[model samples]
Target: MDSISQLPDALLLGVLSLLPAKDVVATMILSKRWQFLWMFVPKLIYDDNYQNIEFERLSRFVYRSLLLHEAPVIETLHFIIRPKSNVVDIGVWTRTAVKRCVRELIIEMDCSSSSTAPVMLPRSLYSGCSILVKLKLKKVVLVDVTSPFSFPSLKELSLKSVKYPDEEFVQSLLSNCPVLESLVVKQCPNDNATIFTVKNSSLKSLVLENQDLRYNDIGAGYVIDAPSLEKFKIRDLHEDRFCVIENEMPNIVEADIDVAYGHPGKILSSITSVKHLTLCITSSKDAYPVGLAFCSLVYLEIWTLDTEWSNDLNLLMCVLRDSPNLRALKLEQLDCDGDRSCWMEPSSAPECVIWSLETLELVDYEGAEEEKKVIAFILRNANCLKKATISTESTDPNKRLEMLKELELFPRRSPNCQLAFYYSP
Candidate 1:
């Protein structure tokens, strides 16, 4: 009884459709022609870790494995259940995987530390799947569905820890997902999606995470226009919310602005055609007004959470004097305000440190003396610099050799500049 069990039967159901639907129903005890061959296995995954089971014996083993799944065409149906799972057995396993035509439907019914009751997303999966192309939901609950919501070949959507019944029912479920294109909204500790309007034009990658504005109610906000966006991310949106930008996104390149406590409002001049920007804030009102022209900036990242090092080095010298084609710079100092005092250099210099800066990175470096005078004013004015990396938070040994001999006596003006240091624990 070998010869690889006499392969065939569509090459053993394509190797049991790469297992895991309880290991392809435990190969039905490998006999009787592998018994019903896991009913033509076609990718049916049920990730169960239901914390100490017994939900009626896991809903009678998912109703006898969907009555021995016959698989006509269900490309992928990943259901992650737990936390009191059993909304009528997830509406009879999402109406039997949308009547066997599912094409990527990932459901995460986490119930968030259950008290059960919160699993209503089975209106025949919005009109019996018109070939769904990817939908991901978490913590489930999206009622108020009226019909006419046709997905028409959806294209990647993710709503984490969801619970919508308003905000125009999440803007009529994102204007009926007509050709969606990668979207992710993560908020849930019983999140109630407060006014998150995204005007998708076949969207192009967006991610908005965590919204808990002390239970917003007085002028809540969040809005985007998505003129065919090109990757955007926003986090926290600290308090006085009212962030709206229902237009202007001339095909953004890449942005990851984090607003944890203040100012990030005008959507940072509507992502002036961003080119890899990441600015985390705590205040310094997100300085960016050197006539706001990041004309397709080139990689700049600065994060500051517990400020005061002269307001994150004056917001990193006003985002390197407004990113004039910035080449590469990453500076991060989340917290450590003993205020050792120093940063008083920028009285000019900074057109990307005198001509398209070239790669510099400092993270959590606390040589203080204002981070060794901002790394000796970027190795004495970048001049098309070529690689400077410091990583210290000084675990003293004479303070990391007095910050590598005070930044190697800073003079450098890039004749192929190069310097390095480490020690971040």
Candidate 2:
């Protein structure tokens, strides 16, 4: 135990950094050296989720920690504050505490107070946030002030359950984060008349989920100009005008397009470079692998379309012709009806088949005759296929065994191939 206590103060401090903030406070009693070590920890996380009342105590904790410690450079600052109570000079005190050491700041504030309106943050708190490289804000609201906000060094940002003063404010925030690489916005709406102009070049990942906008507003004409974007996920419920559009994102490699039914062609038309694509469509004709292509596509998942197995077959034909390098295909949550005729392509259609296809996975498969036909078609064309995963609902023993028997019949021309069928409830 003597050797243990003799550990360097810095190394012991590193151990405490991994502990929760509450636990770190308790370690102050470990020894006198530890007491000073906790003060040097570069990261601080304060979670008030356990407290249902106001976050008045959180301000006190910060005040005490800052007064006692003289940390030269802080790294991460996280606070999830509960609403209602007031603390004197909180904005200024918090701002001073986060002068330079903060490279990442995550603030989750509960702003739904019963009083007049949610309390606004003081202008000084965000003055130094430009140095923050990552930020995740939830349920927080900020007002407009003469101080034009800017965060020039931010790289990754995720905003959830939060609101900006206006749509222009949102765009301004995006513009200020010049080198931002990843952005995620969910369940937030700006003023009705405001327009959010999105323009960034370094953004590589973009996710717009649950964009709640008023009717007839047609969503602030979003213009994405990120040429290096490699991944994109769009989930929208409000079917407004299907005003969705995809700007120049040629580097996209993997994407999931979840569309609302009324908006057929809402998804962007040009995703030619995507290597793996998943379409969550409700209509058979809602989308077809058309002019846009994925020559390097190695994996594809087409889910939530018509129950006709033939529809999948026809789409695969288009994909095979375009993506000659396609290998693995994953079909999940497919509800296909017994329609056998959709499997064949016209004689004039370009020859399309997965010559190198190896692995196939079908989740939630129902043993319809036409569905089996599609499965057989894959087996016949993909001469190099080594294994197939057929998963079905297990609630019914008869249907589960039925699928296993039908899929077991596919002649594994390449004995090197094996089929694994699973019945998942």
**Top candidate, metric TM-score:** 2
Tens digits of lDDT, candidate 1, 1-425:
56767888888877877766777887878888888888778777776663455667767876788776887777888887875766877888888778778888898865546465567876778888888899898878877766676788989989986888777777777778878989998766445666678777898999988665555554566788778889998887556656688789888899898875455647778888889998887766544454677867889888876446676777778767877888988888646666534457767887877798888898978765666677777878888989889887667789788878878888888889888888878
CA displacement after TM-score superposition, residue 120 of candidate 1 (Å): 8.0
Q: Tell how far residue 59 is off in model 1, in angstroms.
A: 17
User: Could you give candidate 2's per-residue lDDT for residues 79-111 as a string of tens digits?
Assistant: 656555452444555566556557777776655
Task: List where candidate 1 sits over 4 angstroms from the true fold.
Answer: 1-82, 89-108, 111-120, 124-136, 139-148, 151-182, 185-200, 204-227, 232-250, 253-273, 278-295, 298-324, 331-353, 356-361, 364-391, 412-425
The lDDT for every candidate, in the order shown, is 0.77, 0.66
lDDT of 2: 0.66
Error of 2 at 338 (Å): 10
Q: TM-scores for all candidates?
A: 0.33, 0.85
Off by over 4 Å in 2: 1-4, 50-54, 85-94, 110-119, 189-196, 211-221, 241-247, 261-268, 284-286, 307-316, 337-352, 412-415
Candidate 2 displacement at residue 90 in angstroms? 6.0
Worst window of 10 by summed lDDT in candidate 1: 334-343
